[model samples]
Target: MSRIKKLLMVVVALLLLAVGGLYLYKDAAVRSGVIASGDQVLGADSTTLDSASLDLFGGGLALRGLKLKNPEGYQQPHFFQLGGIDVDVSLGSLLARRIVVPSIALDGVELLVESVIDLDGPRLNLLTIRDQLRSSRVKNAEENSASSGQRFVIESLTVSDLKVMGLMTIPGGGSWPIDLDVPTFEIRDIGKKQKGVLLAEVVGIILVAMIDKAIDMIESDGSDKLKIAGDIRRGLKFFNRGLKESGLDPKLGKKLLDDAIQKGLGDLLKKKKKDR
Candidate 1:
């Protein structure tokens, strides 16, 4: 019996050692992935991976002060630097094949839009940074689908605080500054197939907004009116199609959107009509 007990102890010790080694290995890998991912997303090299820790046993992970260098000529470097990003992801939630992002928080995100036209365009491109995030999520989803464990999914995304600065060129001279604060943004069920369809609708809305903003920028009374109407029509078409596919009342949705657009642009259109 003593011999058997000793043998069992040896086996248990070996098992414990194996488990400990695996935990450490996985912890390191997770940290490396986080650092690499942060670098890739910013299109910049990682300047720091100050602290990265993982607790696989308890399904907790943390990454802190992951910094990235700004791309050359990008305002982020000159004006404001991305201080760092903090992320905490759940391991069990990740393996459960559900939208499982516990939290992603970014701090000190900076952008400098130069008054110069060439720099301004690239600065404006920064607005599309969400696209890169979406791509990363998609890649994660694909990996999760492949794994037997539940994939990390994102059901809702919360933006705690966001600041945007837009530098616009005036027709004859100086720059006009537009500052925006996005206090909260929630995106739902983004990890599912329906995400594509939902994203299409969102992109459509953004396109409409861009067109309207462009028309406003033109600053010609008649031009604004014409362009606003065109944008309204385009947005309605997209809304109509989405509603139809969703098996909702397409006509009602289209009519409602049209009414809202018309009401909003009423004065502009009426003045144009009178001038004509």
Candidate 2:
């Protein structure tokens, strides 16, 4: 081999090594940044993750043992808890102090019960966040111009094995676990404006999604678990069948869910009547 050719090869290899090292460094930084962003976007006490690791090859991060504490005045310890989360981001956007995720997913999610006796009701932790998202401003010139402005745009999100388990907070109430398979939830246009957006707004979209799934859990199992709705209907049907084949009756496992579902329907009917 010629001497000059060997020198060029060495330089190219070094450049590749440097780029790979930079990616590794960025991975660590992004993990820490995501945790900090979550804490600030959610409440200080609301977001907690046991561990986070980035996948350079996948261009994303995997977060494990993630938990979201309940809002104030709730007896439950956590409003939402998950085994793991996977997020794929756009590298350019991430470097620019923004989060542009092409894909994100939650694995093994759990939503706890409400504070009061409303077994099938939504948790205040999620409800409060959902309401906040509704009221949040999409763009703020002053906030956007800040030195450390951050925005998130998620093009796709997938939630897997989302379960709702009632803690039996009320006396004489049995346990109730209503499961939903990727309950439908969509929040759009928060990052479209992109110039001026806060972490709180981004986090609120996530929290509201959690709330929307929890509400679906409450609504899906009403006297007719047979009629599960959304893109999840087929998945739910297959899951129920598999549960029975595994020797467990998802519906009859506890009478609590049935009773709570009935109560939910009754309340809805009463409110409708009163409105008339």
Task: Quantify all predictions' global Cα lDDT against the true fold.
Answer: 0.43, 0.57
Which ten contiguous residues of candidate 2 have the minimum total lDDT?
A: 167-176
**Deviation of model 1 at 223, angstroms:** 16
Q: List runs of model 1 lying over 4 Å from the truth.
A: 1-11, 22-28, 40-48, 55-60, 78-91, 94-99, 102-150, 165-173, 176-179, 194-276
> What is the alpha-carbon lDDT of model 1 when measured against the actual structure?
0.43
Writing each residue's lDDT as its tens digit, candidate 1 over 18-39 gives 9778776875766675555555
Q: Which candidate tops TM-score? A: 2
For all predicted structures, in order, the TM-scores are 0.48, 0.57
Clash number for each model: 5, 0
- Candidate 1's error at 257, in angstroms? 38
Q: Candidate 1, residue 202: CA error in Å? A: 17
